[model samples]
Target: MIRLVIIGSGNVAQHLIQAFQKSLVQVVARHPETLHSLPISCPVVTSMNEIADAEVYVLAVSDHAIAALGHEIPGTGKLVVHTSGATGMHVLPKHHRSGVLYPLQTFTKGKPLDYSTIPFCLEADKKEDYLLLEQLARTVSSAIFSIDEQQRLALHLAAVFVCNFTNHLYQLGADLCAEHGVSFEVLKPLILETAAKVQTLTPTQAQTGPALRGDTATLERHQSMLTQPYPKEIYQLLTQSIIDHVQKL
Candidate 1:
């Protein structure tokens, strides 16, 4: 049995805890600020000092604490992995076998994750630890990739642009619509379709609109329609990028 200890009770932790429970693995849930709450019955430890006898220790905490807590784990061989996409695997102390187990999808507390769909981006120092982590990951996710620390960091950077920046743009779109007396709900279909497209279509290949086609009249009309600087700026930048992307083809 791969005894697992999860070191945080946040959104990612909740998703992982449930996923592991569904697989019938022994798991310990703990949190720094809040009590671990899951209706599915498991040992919840409130402090780090209480942790004992774990084959795999998952540090699901924020990026800041990984180093310090990694220093405190008094062993040389525990498979200590963090659930951070940005932080490097070596952030853990060299005394222990370290790795990263970043789940590439956003997680929310109490919401069920179809673990089978979520990609596990895993990396480890030792071959044995790497294989163990991969096996454990495959139990929860069908897609498991053996990524290096460098590749994981690059993917994390790309995620910022794809997920984070795209969401920010959506916010800008919502605000632009609201100022024009348009309902935010009206953008919902476009949003859903945009997400669905990238699953099959390379985002650049799926690109559409006046900008990609260089319909200057419609582009001018879009700019003119935006009465405010914010939306106008976004329109200008993205349209220019689209034009560039289309020109490359």
Candidate 2:
């Protein structure tokens, strides 16, 4: 069994911890503070000093914390890896072998994920290190990709636009529908179809609307119905982007 010590116990840590445990990897220790209020069932430590030896130490902390603790973690020729999407593998402690094991998906505590379907973007300096990381990731995910630093950054940004920004748009749609005494569920089919089309079409190509058709009248009326803070500029900007896409087509 590969002895795995996960540094942080947040959502990403929790998910990874459970996954590692289920895969029969020995979870050596986790940071107590990272566990926070979550009732996580694992051996935890408040500091790195108390930790026993492990084959791998996973730094699942925030981007900022990775660099700080990168130097603090003791070296055992153990694989030191971070779960950061944008941060390079070299950001970890220099004495220990370093790598990345970023799972390109949003996570929430207790929300189950099918790891086998999730893409694990991996990177490492040495061939053996890369192979080791790849094998560990493959223990759960079948969709592991040997992505370099730059591509991982791009994938991360794309996720932000698709997941975070799209959810914000959904929230706005629900609020607007509520104000008009319309059921938000009415938008469910449209939302589902939009997501479905993306699996078939590039987001840019799948784009459709009054903006793409240059249907100014509908755009104006829709803009009129929207109130305060986010309507005018966002509508004009996104619509112009869609118009640009259509023109390119």
Candidate 3:
């Protein structure tokens, strides 16, 4: 079995520990107490010096801390990988074999995830290292892709628009519902249907709303109903965007 020494105790690290429990030899964290919540059997070390010999060192820390943390690892020969979407593989210690093992999904601590469905984006400095990364990735997830640094960064940008922005819109909708004395539950079916539609239809094809239909009167009334400047501004911007997209189509 290919042993892994995961460094960090954050959301990505915890999830990875669960997924690779069988191969996980040890977990290195600055605060060992942060890992107490996890239900893993692997030994947890507070220092990098205590990290056991392993085939791969998985740095599941923040993007900013990756380079500094990479320097602390004991050896230069071991394969070191980080779970950052925005960071490039070159940020890791130049002496060690560097790679990226970014998972293309939003991670919330304590939330259950099916590892098989989560896409694992892999990159490495050497072909053999990439193959080894792929071998490790396949152990947990079947949805693996060999993406380069630029492509990975682009994908991360797209993910923010689709996931983060969409969730914010949902929160805005919930707030609007609460303000008007309506149950947000009423919109649940519509939300689920809209999501389901995009599975088979392209986003453009799935598009529907007063803005998409060019219903100026309805759009005006909706805009007038929004008292808050922020929501109103967002609505106007999105309405104009939808109109522009339709005009381009």
Clashes per model (N, Cα, C within 3 A): 0, 0, 0
Model 2: per-residue Cα lDDT at residue 229? 65
Cα-based lDDT at residue 20, candidate 3: 92
- In candidate 3, stretches whose alpha carbon ends up further than 4 angstroms from where it belongs are none
- Residues 51-159, candidate 2: write the lDDT tens digits: 6577777888889889877677775577889999979876787788989999998897667888778888999879898998888887888988999999989999999
Over 4 Å off, model 1 = 22-37
Clashes of 3: 0
Whole-model lDDT per candidate: 0.79, 0.79, 0.93
Error of 2 at 46 (Å): 3.5
Q: What's each prediction's TM-score?
A: 0.91, 0.88, 0.96
Task: Give the alpha carbon lDDT tens digit for every residue of 66-178 in model 3.
Answer: 99999998977889999999999888998899999999998888889999888999999999999999999999999999999999999999999989999899999999999
* Candidate 1 C-alpha lDDT tens digits along 116-228: 99989999888889898888887888999988878988998998998899999899888878888999999999999999998999987688888877799999988888887
- Screening candidate 1 with a backbone cut-off below 3 angstroms (N, C-alpha, C), the clashing residue pairs are none
- Whole-model lDDT for model 1 versus the true structure? 0.79
* lDDT of predicted model 2: 0.79
Per lDDT, the best of the predicted structures is: 3
* Most accurate candidate by TM-score: 3
